[model samples]
Target: MITPMAIERTFVRTRKLATLLAGATLAASTTLVAGAAPASAAGPCGSSYSRVGVYAISRGDGTRTGTLEVYYSSSARKNCALTYGYGAYANTRSWKRVTISRADGSQEDTDANYYTYYAGPVYVSAPGACIDVAGTVPDWVTRELNNVHCG
Candidate 1:
C-alpha cells in the first residue's frame, strides 16, 4: 500500500542517492583533470626553447628520482639543459647539477647547487655540432647523453 508518507520517504531517498552520485562524479572528474596537467608548459627552459632530449635520473636501486632535459633554440643556435627533481626528491632542498657542452669541448656550462626543485638552464652554443648533456641528483645518481642532436 503506497501511502502519502511512504511515497515521500522513497522520493527523498532517491534524491539523496542521486545527489551522492553526482558529488562522487564531480570529485572524480576534478582529480582526473588535475592529474592530467603537465609539469610546466614552457618548462624551466623558457618559451623560445624546444625540448630536444630527456634522460632519466635514477637511484642506485633503480627508482626514478628526476629527469635530465635538453632544450634547443634554433634561432639562438643554443642548447640548454636542466635537472628537474621529482617523486621523493621534489621540493626538498638537495644537491642537483646540470651541464651542457659542445661535443668538441669548446663550450660548456654547468649549474650545481642545493636546489629544491631543479638546477640549471645551462646553455651551450652547438649549432653545427653535437651536444653533451648531463645531470645529477642526490646520492650521486648521474645520467648523461653524449653526442646527441647533431646538426
Candidate 2:
C-alpha cells in the first residue's frame, strides 16, 4: 500500500537519477568533439628567427609527424618559414618547402631535399604589409599561416 510520503520519495529518487544520466550524456558528447587545430611541433625555431606560428601537416595516417613553422626577425624585418620531418628514412626521398607572398602578388619560395634531416629557413621581406606564408613536405600536404601583419 502506497502512502503520500512514499510516493513523494519515489518521485524524488527518479528525478535525481534522471539528472545524473543527463550530466553523463553531456560529458560523453563533449569528449566526442574534435579539435580544429593540431598541437605545436617541437623545440625553439632557432637563434635568428622568432617563431610566429606552427602548423601540423596532414599525413594519410592522421599522425602529427610533419610540421611547418613561421618566424619573424625584428632586426632584419623579414618573415621566414620552415618545414621539418621526424625520423630519417633510408633511401627514401624527402623534401621541404616554404613560400611567402606579398600583398602586391610578389612571392618567394624556397625548397630543399634532405637525404638526412631538415629542410630550409626560407624567407621573404615582410615590411609595411600583410604577408601569407606556407610550407610543404614531399608526397604529403602543405600547411599555411595566412595573412599576418608586419611592419
Best by TM-score: 1
Q: Where does model 1 exceed 4 Å of error?
A: 1-42
RMSD of 1: 4.8
Instruction: Estimate, for each residue in 1-151, the C-alpha lDDT of model 1 and write its tens digit.
Output: 8899999999999999999999999999999999875665565677679988888999779998889988888888888899988788888998889988998777889999999989999999888899888899875899988899997
Tens-digit lDDT string for candidate 2 (6-66): 9999999999999999999988877665442225423344455678777877666765556
- Candidate that would win on lDDT: 1
Each candidate's clash count? 0, 0
TM per candidate comes to 0.71, 0.56
lDDT at residue 1 of model 2 (Cα atoms): 94
Alpha-carbon RMSD to native, per candidate: 4.8, 11.1
Clashing pairs in 2: none
